[model samples]
Target: MNGTDLLALLPEGWRRVPLKATCNFFVSNVDKHSFDDELPVRLCNYTDVYKNDRVSPDMELMAATATPQEIERFHLEVGDVVITKDSESWNDIAVPAYVEGTADDFVCGYHLAFIRPRKEVLDGRFLFRCLQSRPVALQLELEATGVTRYGLPKDSIGLAVLSLPPLPAQVRIANYLDGEIARIDGLIAEKERMLGLLEEKRAALISRVVTRGLDPNAPLKPSDQDWLGEVPAHWEVQPIKYLAVVGNGSTPSVENASYWSDDGYPWLNSSVVNEPLVIKASRFVTETALKECHLPKIQPPAVLVGITGQGRTRALSSLLGIEATINQHLAFIKPHCDALHPGYLCHWLGHAYAFLRSDSDGAGSTKGAITCEQLANMRIPVPPTGEQLEICAHIRKSLDVAEPLQSEIQNSLNLLMERRAALITAAVTGQIPLEELQP
Candidate 1:
């Protein structure tokens, strides 16, 4: 199971086949309906299935008026696979799921499609898993035809092929996966908990650094800033303009549109900075566009922040190291790294983010922005240089511990997801024996 590709792991005498060949198409269209009582059948949707391969009956929305008799022809036999034909994004468009119990007989909207396998040819759960693999997503993407965005069209899936395993082996593979995935899932959950705890600890460490400095025994006094409340007696409150410079961004003409090609100068938007450290941006701008707009290239890792748009979004600031341009929705802040201690400023800015953002003097508009004057008045408590370094050092150590925990959490979850995928692949392809399955 650990050493082979899904195809290599299959049992003897199994054959790979396209979905079009072995299963009867189980579909129903929208027809006039009625609804007073709750439908007995459990309805399902693409959302009902998770990327983790977990099924949620809660996503089920019922139409009591749906025709039970009409639905019967489309009835899901235990082991039938259900799929979603369309989704908001290509990544979400197709989700294949295994059906069990009365949910098999439930009515679905126009977006869902079901497949009931012919007994001698394929396993229901196995086929569903194959439809979810990276290979399947690639196939689905190739078939999409939308002008604005891609999707998983039913036409492509109608002709899709998959490996079919013998029944007993299919059962064994599914059972093995059920147990294996459960253990992986447990570990992933634990890692996630550790990550949450790590984040909390980091946040607390920063708060302590910015407020108390490195000396827990340092003399303390009340802070004049309303939100800050108190700080170390030696700490001094100073305006941001004294410590940093802020700049805005611009967009060039879109009518001529020559600057819209993929290979262009990188452009960073506020949304791009909405994540911590703002590592990447979604779009690129042409050199011509940047020149036309007369926008200067922003120094990376300079603590770019969003000041004018997207209400109450976090990560308004990011620490970047590359050169890029930003949109009007953001403000690029260049810290006096030599004297101010850049890491300390980034951490302190993060702490005062909510209060500083609220203090901005924009119009009564939903998106609040501050003028240069308002920014110049934005006060932050400045601990002595030595203490600032101490605080920054503590922060670095805390992040060192936190970041790896977060990575482990994601890795564990990824392993569970992959194992789940492999299980589905093996079951459908008859890599395991069903009679050997205990449940």
Candidate 2:
């Protein structure tokens, strides 16, 4: 990231200059707090910068209070660039979001840097594109400091170098990029929308098969529970407690070093529920920790459910493919009877995800937790063992057909993102000629 190395990376017409030479930059300390003495302002917070390419007037910003001095010093304006100065990882450091348009009250919030390009030497849009480029971005990443939480020091931000083109050329490149990027973004949005539809289809398929038998003309019977509605006539509708041994586990004390080891008993947390099948442990707990914590070692053919979480995590289910112990936030259901297949049970739980979440919210738990007792009492449709296996096979076959299509769409998305980044880098660095974009 030295001047010579950066200059070498740029084309002949482009010259390298320190970022501070082309822009006025400052790190903001104004936080998301309101005081009676301070004036009210709409704050462009860290997420606003991290999640968007441009911060515009249409986006809803956080409401906070800032002192007159802070308001004067940190007020946002058009053509200004906001970058994340601090993050949990180095890759996220110095992620820039341009201020496309802003209100008078909009001020930069904490953990972000406000950069205004010196218009005589740099076009704001072009500078923003340069920041998105790999050559300049890599410099910021290398300068980031900290072990757990990374940050770009003010000196590093000021010293970072950029490939500068002539003002007219910068404007031309920016304009070309703006149009091209929009098209790519539109394509990406469509691919993402398709992914959403696929997910909905997958969920619907699982829900339908688990609740109803594979036979199209199967007779239906009322299951008493509103959520259960009508199930296959031959299937038994009963509380889970009758078919499985439902229980939970606990975490060992982290303060005791002996509780954790690299080679020890496999231990999992509620996040395991995110995976359709849990085949490996998240971490390891020592033998003494397992005994002292009274953690139950759940065997295979068990269904794991995230019983506690604030977001969509609650009621998410996963099939345990390996012997493991879980934290208290997870409930393990080990089928004790011969009639129920763990796969079928997991699918049923997946189908019941929304209902379980609703139940958790209405149970009057302030934290939105589903207890072991609640899970145990929940009703499920139980088809014959033979039918359950066939249904599981059918679901897997359906997934096999859908999985490739999803992967193909995902690959297309990856390529589009790569192309977008490469195009921005090429244009900003003058590697691609402006004439190429002309009709």
Candidate 3:
């Protein structure tokens, strides 16, 4: 059903009220450029509302300066709700956070709106919950508009409608949601921890089998490579360049529309490295673009590594299940099958991911880059062709079992998040009776 139809379902004693009728909406007067860290005031930024339910003085807020007039106008008080005024996605617009308590100098920052609800008519916490409910969120999403960044105009927000139950019922529903959501969040956190442990176990298994070989009784010798303390005596150590052809791809000029195609050669970027075996690209480029850009088509069964990007993407490694061209931010390595198994090389690179990223050199900022030269010189423990295949088989078999367990845990986490959202929506809309939850 449509949002208007959903709003019509408000129960008895619950009236649909324009938000402005019961709340005072104010936009921040201070711009980001005006912020001064030396000043003692705390600024409640967009993330404060988008990521949290309540703002507190103890939280790490951005420090800034505000003029006396601005502070007087935008200062946060208990029972005030802060909301995101703009975001990259429509679903994130108008997300709200209730102000429980804040430092004496706390003021709302730009790209946000401060909402002060009339205490006798509305509960700020309940209003915050209501704004996040499915019906209201759907309405907000439908109303938000922008070419690049979605936004909710102050007037539009003021005109938005919400189902307002009696103040006592509002309080009861909010209290009931607080306990139930907290319980669901706890389960999500535990599942997340389990996923982390599973990933760690998988990494350790890959590292051990790839470097040491599957045989526990294999004799060891000093490899003399700093990263490789020792390896099986029969194994050989070689720079990755000796065993593979390593290179990066290029992007054609985006200004030239002729360079792109609806269906052409698959063009890959560093982000595709996140997939276990990349077989498709988000966008394709024309043959003209490929030739003009000098993009190299990496053959299938090659290992792909992200050479640029923040966080873990720089260290991400994957195997290519199809022939594709990559952007400059990715390095493709085609291993010589006679010397090294592609799967074995991919797993070894995965094992050395952290070290490879840490040891890389670039113009500046080690956080998100690795040069082609640095990647070529990276060392690997190489076994005989037969041994390499054996090791790859062992690692793949272990992952065959562990991967499904990880997927199961991840599915559980996803369900918990959906359950949390559904529960909040149900409670705030009065679908769940408050009387059933009270002690």
Candidate 4:
């Protein structure tokens, strides 16, 4: 009812009603397990609903088992809407995706619900746009309940109130929105592609300077590796172990009360490696945990590489700018700075990212994981200390030139997204008149 008060201000032809008045909703319980006693079916899962605006038969769906009863009760039709009913964050509840087509074996999966329109009172496409509006989203966000994970009770969803115009007006609004949204989405995709190309150009610049040095005309020699191809003739190719100490760290036991503290020793995880330089920790561990868990204290001026991750974090390198310990997934490379500068070593490791990932797979370690022993034996080209410093300075200067352009593109992307959200809210709430769309 709190969300419905705003509907009192609606235009003369529109009226407010609880969502259940126009649609029949069901919370699904079909799990992903493939039981031998059940029928095989393709499930319209949580991600399928959350990441998409419409679901069709052509999209890839997970194959699972469901009871005949589940298939009958939860089967999706072209006019039905599926929404995420539960999530780790409250704000993410009730993300709706309209059913665009139907397959006999398709059913709603766990953590989502099915909403079928009564057809006479509600238009499915118009209802979907209303759910996407901020007013409906606010009601769902407030009703979601949980400590670690949030869920919407059936009653809470059934009682959600929204204002609706006549079926004719709903159709017109949906049609206008369809054309405008597609145009905005096209522009957004084009700008995102441009942002990616700019990032690629910046990376290529760093790779060229670090590999070829400041003097492009310098003499070259074969490095005997396909990835390296050739290097400056004066540079020496050496194993990392010969020029630095490679080691790893472990996590303190989280189950023990004494292991954590409000103010304690800094501890880091593999995520910090996403930053070019790490100067802080995400959490803190007690000194007792440090001693009991045998976590090693890594000093500053070391480079950290994410050795294992389920994502692109693996093989990504960062400089350690603060004295802190790390989890086992990160390998700390403390260079013998009289020979290998940490900044130079960090840049070179970043350039070697592709090779590191491939080498890890070839070493027979767990897929996408790298061990400290393998990293210690990895080879790199070593330039003179003075040249390494000069290269680092040149890389910094190049980044300073590129940063402003990247920021400008990112700001443009943000504006486009904000515009998309505003347009949806205006059309669904009757703030934008249908007469204005006559063209």
lDDT of each: 0.65, 0.88, 0.82, 0.87
Model 3 per-residue lDDT at 15: 83
TM-score of candidate 4 relative to the true fold? 0.69
Please tell me which predicted candidate would have the highest lDDT against the true structure: 2
| Candidate 1 stretches greater than 4 Å from native | 1-128, 141-161, 164-175, 219-229, 233-257, 260-264, 268-284, 292-296, 305-317, 326-332, 336-341, 349-387, 398-439
lDDT string, candidate 1, 1-439, tens digits: 4434655655566665667787776554533234554245555544554333544344445443455565676555667777766543455556776666455445554566677777786666656667766666567666765422235555567677666666666555556666765676787677677778877777778887898887778898887777888888988888878888877786655555765557677777656555667656556778778778877687755777666632454325667667888776666777764556666777887787777676664345443575545555677888878878888887888778678757877887777667766765555545456655553
**Candidate 2 per-residue C-alpha lDDT over 1-439 given as tens digits, one digit per residue, 9 for 90 to 100:** 7857856867667787899898999999999879999999999989888889999767898899999999999998899999999975588899999999878788999999989998898999998998999988999999998643578998898898887878988999889999999999999999999999999999999888998878979999998988679988899988899999999998787678999999898998777788998998757999898888899988898999988755466899999999989888889999998888999999999889888888788735534899999989987889999999999999999999999999999999999999999999888888887688641
- Give the per-residue lDDT of model 3 (tens digit) for 247-312: 998777767889888789898877777788897877789989888889998788899998874336
TM-score of 1: 0.59
Worst lDDT run of 10 residues, candidate 1, spans 30-39
Q: Which lDDT tens digits does candidate 4 get at residues 1-439?
A: 5646766678778988899999999999998789999999899999899889999777999999998999999889998989899975588899999999998899999999878988998899988888888888889889998633579998888788878899999888888888888899999988899999987887798788778899989999988778988999999888889999999988766568798887788888877888998988757888998899988888889999999843578899999999988888889999865788999999998899988888876634477799898789887888999999999999999889888988898899999989988998999888998898541
Q: Which candidate wins on TM-score? A: 3
Which candidate, 1 or 4, has the higher lDDT? 4
RMSD to native, candidate 2 = 5.3
Sort order, TM-score high to low = 3, 2, 4, 1
Name the 10 consecutive residues with the lowest summed lDDT in model 4.
359-368
Candidate 2, lDDT over the whole model: 0.88
* Lowest lDDT block of 10, candidate 2: 358-367
Badly placed stretches (over 4 Å) of model 3 are 1-4, 12-170, 225-227, 249-259, 269-271, 357-363, 433-439
Sort every candidate by lDDT, greatest first.
2, 4, 3, 1
Q: Model 4 residue 405 lDDT?
A: 85
